[model samples]
Target: MTKIFMAMIALLYAIPAYAMDGTAFLKQVDRNLNPESYESYRKLINVEPDGRKKEYTLFTVKKGVDKVASIFLAPASEKGRSTLRLGDNMWFYIPNVGKPIRITSLQSVVGGVFNNADILQLDYAAEYTVEKVEQNGNEYLLYLKAKTKTVAYDRLKLYADGKRKLPAKIECLTEASMLIKTIYFKEVKDFGGGVVRPAVIETDSPLYKGYKSVMIFAKVKARDFRDEAFTLTFMPNLESLR
Candidate 1:
């Protein structure tokens, strides 16, 4: 009887260790994607059901956990437009408006599968808590829950590569578990300074049936910036940072 009780106690102690391992791996995945503060360039392409496509280029900068900013760099119309995210607060700045306008995580700035929250995303570990983790064959499936209601997606199903510890796909869902969109990470590349991650991210949604969006990342290198660089006043001056 004492041996059986000891085995049961050992099993109980093992449970929490398993849970912590999942969360710890999640943090590692986040760091593998990008440095805490860095800059990069991305080309966003939106495709219609008819194959018509529109593209926009952006220079993005991210600072510690809750600060990120992005500015349009190509296409004359989108040039000079910028977006900033400071914690739960987000804002869009237009050249003509000359003032920052508040925005929500659910709203799309460029109109596609990716929303404002996705474009200016912070570390996943920052906005989400791992609810559970499962190992499926060669992949790790992470069940994530939003830390707060203000988050864009209520829950996320993240499937990561077991060998690389990088995300392979993510499914965004509503509170009632309705499917919103699925994001696929692809084309891994090394951008120097230990920054090796997916260079292409494609997303599609049942809600936006027949439409798709793709983001191609480039020049994703580690670099530091001042706090002012992620503020509204610096939105117009974002280009200068690059």
Candidate 2:
């Protein structure tokens, strides 16, 4: 009779630990998404079908808790080209144009493929709230809701690797529950220092067929960028980036 009572006490104590599963999982995923510690990486991007490849040395720096700035230097083809993001705004520098073009945060990032928000290094926590944990085989899925009017998609469903807890796939849904984009993460690797980074990301839009963008991170290394590198006034310095 005493053993049975002890076993009942143990089971009652385990309830609190089991209840922490959702919050614990959310915090773990958030830690991986925080870009503050993952300052930079050497990137290689390959656009599909065309078999085109480009290389860039990249840098990421956090301005505050909800703000991050990333810089790209593609010396091979896009030499002297610079892209900057401050909060929700993005700007580009073209050597031929001799000026920086201000790209609004909502301009739908036009380039190889994918929407502007997908490329913009914005604060994910501000825009989305995650919940409704579901497990299917080896994957865990969560429903993310846009918290503000400024967001592009109304909802996003994310599928994460069950064992690794890294993002595996993301599905975007419109305000009316229409599907818009589906992004898949492949070849994810740890970028050292406990950052689980996605090496290859392939984004596909439902509006376009036979069109997709595959970003491959060939090398990832920690880096430091001066404050001047992330400023709008310093956008035209191609020679200084090298």
Candidate 3:
């Protein structure tokens, strides 16, 4: 009983009263995020400075480490399109082209604007090291440094809702010490058991001033996915995965 009490005390100290310890916050975030049995309806709206707007709806599913799939539907514009990221490989399906293109590690990302590595959602524990913690009013901040050059962002600053333990904002710094992008979590909802997923994610880039991409999740479903669903053989049938 004494040891348990000590552990509890250590945990309390590790988690700040107004903010979570940098490393400890990440540990909790990792624990609370379940890659398996996760699926969501994502609507991505991109607004350009030229006033041109494009929207796409994606059905996303994740089974485990390096296993993911996205099916494009809607707007009557993006039909029969899909993308699959399995392990380290990313495959792109274009109905107009009638074939799938595989992206290599050396090549750039295909979908949206973020780098492929960034979208792949690499394990946070492997990619970043927590540096410090801070508080801004009611928000708790976590400063992180990239562990390797493979990570697109050299520095990461995360702001979390103090009471909710959910991310409120993220600042990603480029290697040049310039702000690359910032993501704001507008709404967070508990889904599938006790996991908290963002209902909307708004992303803005320094390169594209006055431009932003808003992603809203319309529906979320949790299910068991097979390893084969993320393979090249199944890339053509991405729409059927759902």
- Worst 10-residue lDDT window for candidate 3 reads 105-114
**Can you give the lDDT of residue 176 in candidate 3?**
66
Give the per-residue Cα lDDT of candidate 1 at 30.
91
- Candidate with top TM-score is 1
Which pairs of residues clash in candidate 2, taking residues 3 or more apart in a chain or in different chains?
none
User: Which 10 residues in a row give candidate 1 its minimum summed lDDT?
Assistant: 11-20
Could you tell me which residue pairs clash in candidate 1? Answer: none
Candidate 2, 1-242: lDDT as tens digits = 99999999776543333333544565566566544433554453435556665445544454433444445665556656566676556777777777778876545433555555666545555567765666655567777788776676778888887677777888888878788878888876777766666878787777655567766654344444566666778776534543
Q: Model 3 over residues 116-198: C-alpha lDDT tens digits? A: 55444544555689887776556777878988775667888888776666777889887666888898887677766666768
Candidate 1 residue 211 Cα shift, in angstroms, is 0.6
Q: What's the distance in Å from true for residue 89, model 2?
A: 2.4
What TM-score does model 1 achieve against the real structure?
0.92
Kindly report which residue pairs in candidate 3 clash with one another: none
lDDT of all predictions, in order shown? Answer: 0.91, 0.62, 0.70
What digit string (tens of lDDT, one per residue) describes model 1 on residues 1-65? Answer: 99999999777544433534777888998998899999999999999999999999999999999
Candidate 2 deviant stretches above 4 angstroms: 1-27, 33-35, 42-65, 75-77, 106-110, 221-229, 237-242
Question: lDDT score of model 2?
Answer: 0.62
